[model samples]
Target: MINIFKIAARNLLRYKRRTLLTSLLITVGVVMVILFSGLSGSFKQMMIGLITDATLAQMQIHKKGYVSSIDTSPLNLNLGPKAYGKVRDMLEKNPLVESYSPRIKLGAMLSNYKETTNIRLNAIKPDSEIKVCPALPDRITFRDRESGQGLINPGEIIIPDKLAKGLKIKQGDTVVLVAHNKEGSVNGLNFTVAGVIESVAGPQGKEGYIHIKDARDLLRIDKPEVTEVAIRTRDFNRIDMLYAEINSALAEYKNPKGNPMFEIHTWEALSPFYNIARMIDLMAMSMKIIMIAIVLISILNVMMMSVYERIREIGTIAAIGTAPGKIMGLFLAEGFSLGLISTLFANAIGVGAIYILNIHKITFSFGRTENLLLSPSVNFNELIWVSAIVLLVSIFATIQPAYKASKMEPVDALRHV
Candidate 1:
């Protein structure tokens, strides 16, 4: 084995420039695959985290039929107080349950005293969002730094900064929320502007925030009813288990409505932005496959040229009684050596590049909203997998040239030169 490798190394050194060119091809392929996989994978994770932590949380439980008719933001389809309490109790007792926040989703008219426009509002508890969504408060741009988590109080609300700028409203200003009750009766209430936050996910989902009490009062709901419960888990990967537990624990409280009092949805189901992220992941895998194809073609070209140039040498060794299998092994070793060396260099370069990018906080916009931070993750197992595939493909590429060299007729070998 040592002798075979030494012979292969000698042969490669004889054609140093060709060998370097082949190795460089393999190196480029490896580096491209690693960088694409890392960037795409990180983008998917970042979008998921943004959606879950900022808006969706890991999961949500809504009244039956509520999500189906979500566009209407129907007030009649609400989880009455009894059902809300039951769900909250079930969430509290479960080990998988981290933190949950009850929200009343409402569509209302907003008036800055001079201008009125349509807006969506989420009425919530002032402090319940602490563990549930710590990022939510961290992203509150226009709030006083010390105001802390959740809505400030009744008659105070949070709006998106872009919307606030357009409406020409600011902190401590007054905004009026006018909405219709289930009976179609129009009701109006005034709220002080508490804070402004940047919108994540997209422009369409930008909304205002208010205390639940004010939402009920403005909408004229005689009793406490919630539209949905946004929930967060300590580990988002356990969402499946949490979903099952929620359904199992709430089985006793079934409603005639198709929604059955409460139904939970994972973040993926709640947001559509994930579809774009998934497409990026598919593109990454496709690029890696393309890299393998490039490796096969480039190595085959180099080995074929090497075999043709060394015809006399192959004939001499065959005439002296070298086995055909050994001849094949020599070429295979050459190809393998090139691939192995390239793989090492590529991995090192890829790792360093990712480190530099993350340290510098490299960012690019995924779609419309700008300022998404680049967070490449190292998948060492994937790196190993890619290297193995490249090496194997490189060896396979040598088969035709190696076979031709091994089968050269000894008598015809000395004829040409």
Candidate 2:
């Protein structure tokens, strides 16, 4: 086996230019796959982190029909005091749940004395909200930084910066929020502007935050009713498993019709950005397929050329009693060596490129957020998988050419000038 590989290496070196070109092609393909996979994977993760950490959390639970009617912010669909108690208890007992925030979602009309506009509000307990969405506080601008105050206090609100700018409102300004209760009765309350919040989704997002107690008071809800529960888990990568477990646990709690009263969803289901993530994944897969095609074609073409150019040599070896399988193995070994060497160089170059990119710190904007950093990294498993695919494709590509050379008649080959 060693002698066979040594012979193969010598043969490849004899045609160094052709071998170099083939290896170069495969190396480029592998390198492209690695770099794209690393960069795009990093981008996807960063976007997901921004969305989840900013407001959405990794998972959420809502009344079964509430999400369908979410656009309306239906107060009637709220999880009542008793149901919320049950959910809170369940979450508290679950080790996987890092934190959970109960929010009272409301659609209200905001008036800055002279102007009135619609706004979506999430009323939350500041402490719990911060725990579930750690990035929530970072989004607040124009706050009393010296005081180290919470995101929102009772009788205070954090309006989106765009809304504040449009309304000519500033921090410490007074605003009126008018909303209707589940009973269809109108109520309004005065709130001090705590700060302006930077939009995460885009400029169109008009979500504002207020204290949960204030929301209950304005809506005249004596009982604790929550519109949704945003949850953060300890292991985000295993979120699907946690989602299933939570759903199964909640299944035991049914409504009068014996159907589950609650529904759980991951960040992907809650955010529209998931569509873009899917597109990125599709593009990554397409890149891998193209890499495969490049490796296969390049190896196949080079191996066929090798067999054609060395026909007389092959005939001489055949006449000297060299086994057909030995000749086939020689070609296969050459192809494998080419693939192995190219893959090694490609992995090294790809990793170095990724390292350099991280060192320089690539920054780009997503939606309204600016200067977000991209940290591209490829895992060991991904590198191994790519190498395996390239090597296997190279071997497969050489098989036909190898067989053709092995079957050449010694007499016929010697006759050819």
Candidate 3:
């Protein structure tokens, strides 16, 4: 084995320019793949985080048929006190649940006294809401951000930035919200604008936040019911498992109509942005395919050229009793060496580039979210797999040419020119 590799190295060194050029090509391809993977992976993760942690929690539990008519914020489909108690008890006992927030969703008329417009409202307890959606407070633009205030207090509202601007509403401005209860009773309440939240791109519109107590008073709900329970899991990667577990647990709790009473959904099911995440993943796979093609073609061309140029050498070695298997080993070793050298250089450069990106604090905006810093990184396991793929493709590409060179027989009388 050692002798075969020694011969291979000598042969590759015989064609220094060609060997270097092929290695450079593979290196460039690998580097491009690594960098693209890092950037795309970071972007996809950041977008998912924004959609899940900033807007929709990792998962949600809603009364059956609630999401289908979620656009209307149907009061009749809410989880009654008994159902809410069951859900709360289950979540509180489940180790997977990091935090959960109960919200009362409703549509209300917002009036700055001069203008009135429709707005979707999510009334929630400040403490639990912050735990479930930690990014919510960062979206507030009404008060001095430096001031350490919670999301909202009783008699306070956090309006969307667009609605605030359109209504000429400012911080501490008083707004009136008029809403109707399930019994069709109309009621209104005055609230002070505590903060303004930037509109997040999702299945939400002109949305605002208010204290849950205010929602009950405005809607005149005598019973303690909740529209939905947004939940954050301790481990995001295990969300699907937890979702299934929760669904199984809730299966026995049925409505009077003999159907399941509650439905659990992951963030992907609740947001349209999941489609974009899928597209990013597809693009990353395409990039890997392109990298494989580059490695295969570059190694194949180099090995085939080596075989043709060294045909006389092959004939001489065979005539001197070198085994065909050893001859094949020599060529395979050359291809392996080329791939290894390129992969090492590519990983070094790729990691350095990622570090530089972090150092520079590259920032860009997605949708209306701003100042998002790009922290591109590749997992160590991913790096190892990429290297293995390049090496494997290198051997696969060299097989045909190596076999051809090894199968050569001692020429007739060694008379060829």
Clashing pairs in 1: 64-259
User: What is the per-residue lDDT of model 1 for residues 1-417, given as tens digits with 9 covering 90 to 100?
Assistant: 999999998988898898888888888889999998888878888777777777667787887777788888898888888888888888888888878998888999999989998888888875775566667775566546364544468878888777799899999899988999889999998888888877776422487788888998998887888988888876777888888778777666776653356677877777887678778878887988899888999989989998888888888888899899999888899888878888989999988888887888877876544688879987898899998998898889888998888888877764647
Model 3 — TM-score against the truth?
0.94
What is candidate 1's TM-score against the reference?
0.88
Candidate models: Cα lDDT each: 0.82, 0.90, 0.88
TM-score of 2: 0.94
- lDDT-better candidate, 1 vs 2: 2
Q: Name the candidate that leads on lDDT.
A: 2
lDDT of 2 at 62: 95
Q: What TM-score goes with each of the models? A: 0.88, 0.94, 0.94
Top TM-score model: 3
lDDT of 2 by residue, 109-210 (tens): 999999999999999999999999898777788556565576778999999888999999999999999999999999999999989988776312458999
**Worst 10-residue stretch by lDDT in candidate 1?**
142-151
